[model samples]
Target chain A: MEIIKSPDALKAALKATQGSVGFVPTMGALHIGHKTLIQAAREANDIVVVSIFVNPTQFLAGEDLESYPRRKEADEKICSLAGVDYLFYPDVSDMYGEDEVSLIAPDVRGYILEGTSRPGHFSGVLTVVNKLLNIVRPDRAYFGRKDAQQLMLIQTMVKNLFMDVEIVPCHTVRDSDGLALSSRNAYLSADERGEALKISRALTKASHLVGKGVLESDRLYAEMLAVLEPLEVEHVAIVNRAFTPLDTVEVGNTIILVEAVVGTTRLLDNVWI
Target chain B: MEIIKSPDALKAALKATQGSVGFVPTMGALHIGHKTLIQAAREANDIVVVSIFVNPTQFLAGEDLESYPRRKEADEKICSLAGVDYLFYPDVSDMYGEDEVSLIAPDVRGYILEGTSRPGHFSGVLTVVNKLLNIVRPDRAYFGRKDAQQLMLIQTMVKNLFMDVEIVPCHTVRDSDGLALSSRNAYLSADERGEALKISRALTKASHLVGKGVLESDRLYAEMLAVLEPLEVEHVAIVNRAFTPLDTVEVGNTIILVEAVVGTTRLLDNVWI
Candidate 1:
């Protein structure tokens, strides 16, 4: 794999790539979830470009921007093993500068659930994704369903911005214990690690309830809150595919989401029913 | 020339165009100023696309957005004569939607003379321009140097966003009477139109002073303001090409700008020295 840092160097190499190019953007500490995105990109595109930048903008003040883990050598090893073609690791300076034009997320959709808890998060996300998409210019970009709201916002941005790229929404990669794979999982203590499973379990329960015809959003959320009661629950929301809150779950059109704190780490998981 | 009203149709037509495309975005009443941009685009690219949208977002509550001139048939005739390949005139619905994302200009650069007088104007210009640039995806885009701050902001947007297209800055088109060509001039009464010539004339005086090696910005602006006096002048300022205020003009990198009101019509003109 050719590891590039400068935007110019990466853009130069991109000119030579033929056929379809699939891009997978991530924040290092490569795990199984990231592997899934890379594998999908590898299978579909003649060239695969994966970028690892721990975006500081998405983190609200007093959040974990400072301590976000970086395992560059291990990530390089993983990319090599995963048949990745290009690994782009750009510093914060390489990405943003002072007094820059920024993207503000849609009012209603941008400031609810995760966005509500972490204000101005999606704006940061949308802005960086725009910069990355413009830089990569990939024919197809892979994003995990794990960050359902993030996935929805990205899909919205690409469509709204008139960007010509396909978003391949891969299923969320999970552990054998049903815990969603996240680089932040490393921050979880052993006991908190076990409690984080409740997030996924709550999502699974909500899905099962929906399968059993529990359409009312309140009943399903109550059931989820019950399952997540032992942990510190943040919010339980039922939203449409577009992230709009719905009173009732509409199968194939609704996502049941849950966010909770296990010790000091915040975890999120969702299921589309 | 084809007239495209919908975003999808315009994007499709853009893809079908051959070789380099030069885009000139405007808001109707096609004046010689727009023609200068179109002519430059025609010379540089294989196809030239012009969009006339008087974006509402860029207008303040008391601004003339509702009354902005819409000379459609005349604009079409002008484009046909100018050899424009496609003319896109998107309605408000086609360009924006409910709860849309916003582009906020940087704080410092966003709250200066023009931005101070017309708060949030550049935000709207940047937003619509961003949308147009993405949809058109032209190889080169044209802008007049008459709106010095607008040109600088657009250039900043393209560079900060890492957009690959070349930005072609064309000289401001002038009338036989030394008035800068503008769509808003249509709003001016004949007497008001004669009074508006002072803006350009004042800028010419500043340009001459720079040529003669008088570099003090305060003294230079004082001379220009004197020329603009006896007319209702809004602002007269001297700054570097980057739009940052300069105590003394840097001959090779200075821009002197003027904004004046003739009756109720506001006019802007600038010179890059």
Candidate 2:
């Protein structure tokens, strides 16, 4: 795989490339989740491009911008092994300037659940994603369903902006214990890792309850809250595909989401029913 | 010219065509200015697409959105005569939804001058322009320099977002009497139309002064304001190409801008030195 650092260079490279391009954008420190996304991209297109940009704009002031994992060599190896055609690794300067035309997330959909806690986070994600998508000009872009809200918003952006790329959502990849794989998982201590399992456990419990014919949203929320007991849970939201509040679970349409703090690190996991 | 009223149809149409597309986006009034833009596109690309969308978001509340002049038949004829291959004329519903992923212009540059007077205007312009660009996916997009700030902001958006299209800046078209051609000129009465000529005259005066070697911004501003005397001049700005206020004209890198209210109609004109 050829690693490209500049946006202009990537554009030039892609211009010469034939056939459909599939892209998987990620922040470095790749795991099974990122691999799944990359694998999906690899299977679908003639050219596969993976971008490892730990975009600074997506992190809020107090967020872990500095401490975010960066394993460039390992990420390169992963992309090469996964058969990536281009690995875009750009500096913050290469992607952004002093003043920029930024994106604003939809007020309603973009401000609920994850957006409520991280107010401007989706906007940052959107701005960088937009830049990346334009730079790659992929025929299809792969995203893991682990970031359900983000995936939804990105899909919305693609539709609303009339962007000519398909968004392919791969299922969330998880560890044996069901902890959704995340780069932030690196921040978890040995004991904190054990605590993080409760997040997936809560989501599993919600899924089980739904399987047992418990469809009411309040009941699911209560049962999940019990599973997440004694943890500083940010929210245990049960919403439909649109992220709109649901009175009762809609079988294939509902998502049971949970966010909790394990030690100082926050972990998120959700199960789509 | 083929008139495509849906984005999907336009995209499908363009997909079948095997050549470079040049685009000109306008609010339909079929003026000489728009004709100039379309003509430029026709000369430069294998296929030319012109969109006539009076984007509602760009117009502030209480603005003349409802009263905005739209001459569909004339616009069709104009596009046909200008050798446009496709004319995309999507409805508001076709272009927007209830909630959307919108764009926000840069705080400093976007909220000055025209943006200051019409808050969130550039954001609206950026959003619509972004959508249109994505829908058309042209090789080169034509924009008149009459809306100088708008043109600059669009260029900035294209650069900052790493959009693929080249923004071709066309010279501002003017009437024989030196009045800048605008769709909004339809709103001006005969007397107001004559008054609007002073805006271009003031810009002309500034250009002549610069020709005589008066490089100071203050001197240019004073001379332009004097020529615009007794008129309700909004601002007489002497700035560099980047729209930053200049102390002294940088010869090849200066722009003299004038905005004045001709009766109830607002008119704008500028000259690049």
lDDT of 1 by residue, A1-273 (tens): 999998878988998777788999998999999999999999999999999999999999998998988999999999999998999999999989887888889888888888888999999998898888888999999999989988988888777777889999999889999999899899998988877888988888888888888999889878888888788887899988988889998888988888887887888888877
| Model 2 Cα lDDT, one tens digit per residue, A1-273 | 899999999999999989999999999899999999988888889999999999988888898889998998898998999999999999999999977899999999999888888899999999999999999999999998889899999999999999989999899999898889999999998888987888898888888888899998898888888878778898888888888888998988988888788887878888898
Quote model 2's TM-score for chain B: 0.98
User: For all candidates, what are the clash counts?
Assistant: 0, 0
lDDT score, residue B128, model 1? Answer: 89
TM-score for the B chain of model 1: 0.96
- Report how far off residue A123 is in candidate 1 (Å): 0.8
In model 2, the number of clashes is 0
Docking model 1 quality class: medium
Residue ranges of candidate 2 with Cα displaced over 4 Å: none
Cα RMSD to the true fold for all candidates = 1.4, 1.1
Q: Considering only the true interface residues, what is the Cα RMSD of candidate 2 after superposition?
A: 0.5
